[model samples]
Target: MDISPTLIGFIGFGILLVFLAFRMTIGYGMLALGFVGFLIVAGWNDALGLLQNVPFHTMFDYDMAILPLFVVMGFFCYYSGISEDLYYTVHRWIGQIRGGMAMATVGACAGFAAVSGSGMATAATMATVALPEMRKYGYADSLATGCIAAGGTIGSLIPPSIAMIIYCVITEQSVGTMFIAGFIPGIM
Candidate 1:
């Protein structure tokens, strides 16, 4: 029996949902599902070829190099206390007024973003460095967490951003231009 491509797509999507529900990591699940789909749609040899080439190309891509470096830089910043120092410096500059701690969190996040370039890293780093200070000052939990979350998003817009690098690679855009363009909005 023959199956329409649309039906095959729906089946694949359903299987993906099942994989997700079963707590499989999305990356692995999608890779497995795509391999299976390729085996069905294109023969075994072609599917194997695709499996081999895709990973090779993805791993060797120049843009992909930046991701690991940024992550390591974030770790270095965290362990070396640079992120904490940034938070404290900003806090000192603005910690006198109401909601100042939250504002300082944002400023620190932006500074961290310049080095880290990943929102997750910025958020995690700031959570460790800023959360307790805000709590010590009697800031509400919701406000403190909200500010961190919002500030973390700045990493996606700042220079050296991993997200922008990935996007530039996929879209064939200039990474430097994208990073430069992100500065104004990222600061705001």
Candidate 2:
């Protein structure tokens, strides 16, 4: 049987629309598209074989376990009050400049980025801790918000960063070195 261009276009359009409308997770969207495409091209039997086998491989895959481990680490760090201590330590030292509050915000962000992997988490934590104080201290909203907003990037750049750690593991390099390398880049 011939594969029609019209059918291909229709399927592609359908997938795009579904993704745009629901904003489904990328992995799920890709899996759904792949399953459907396989079914269309190779028929039910082959697609069934793949569908049956893919889940087992994906679920039981060795590398997949790392995600939960890192997530747990981040949650434990937050819940254990590590982020708070970090913020307080930085505030104690630098909480007094014209941009002292802003500097403190940056320091807190840098500190939080050390333990956390997610940039969003770093930003959220810094905002929660610094925003109110900055507001109360007569700091400009733009500088307060902007510093915290930009400081979030530190999470991704700092050593022990989740992204950096992943890269080290994937490349079979030293994690310590990678983390140190991230220190300056993240700070700047």
Candidate 3:
């Protein structure tokens, strides 16, 4: 029986929601659902062939290599105390003003983003470094977490951004140009 793509998509989305509601990791849920969907659509031989080839090609792709390097660099910065230094430097510069802590958080996040490139890494690192200070200063939980979350998103737009790298690779665009284009918007 032939199934329309729309129907399949709706069904898949419903299943994904159920998976999410069950607290399954979204990545694993999507991967499993996608594999099952592909297998159903393409039959076993093609599905198996896809599974075999995709990882090999993805692993060897030159642009893809940058992802791991960025992640490692983030770890290095975190461990070496660079991220803390950045936060403190920004905090010192602005910590006196009311709501200055939030501004400092954004500034630190921007600085870290210039190097880190991954939003998840930036958020995790900043949360570890900034959250405590915010709490100690009596900052509200929502404001503390919200600013960090907002700041972390800057990583995706700043230079060396992993998101930009992936986008450039997929679109056959110049990574350098995209990075340059992102700077003004990312900072603002």
What C-alpha lDDT, on a 0 to 100 scale, does residue 152 get in candidate 1? 92
Write down the TM-score for model 3. 0.84
lDDT of 2 by residue, 73-178 (tens): 6677778888777777887898775677788888888777766666777788777777888889888889988989888877888766778766775787877788
In lDDT terms, how accurate is model 1?
A: 0.92
lDDT of 3 by residue, 115-185 (tens): 98999899999999999999999999999999999999999989899999999999989988999999999
Give the Cα lDDT of each candidate: 0.92, 0.77, 0.93
By TM-score rank, best first, the candidates go 1, 3, 2
Maximum-lDDT candidate:
3
Question: Model 2: clashing residue pairs?
Answer: none
CA RMSD per model (angstroms): 1.8, 4.1, 2.5
lDDT of 1 by residue, 1-188 (tens): 99988998899999999999999999999999999988988999999999989898989899988899999999999999999999999999998887788999999999998899999999999998889988998988999999999999988988989999999999999998998898888777
The reply for model 3, stretches above 4 Å from the true place, is: 15-32
- Residue 36 lDDT in candidate 1: 93
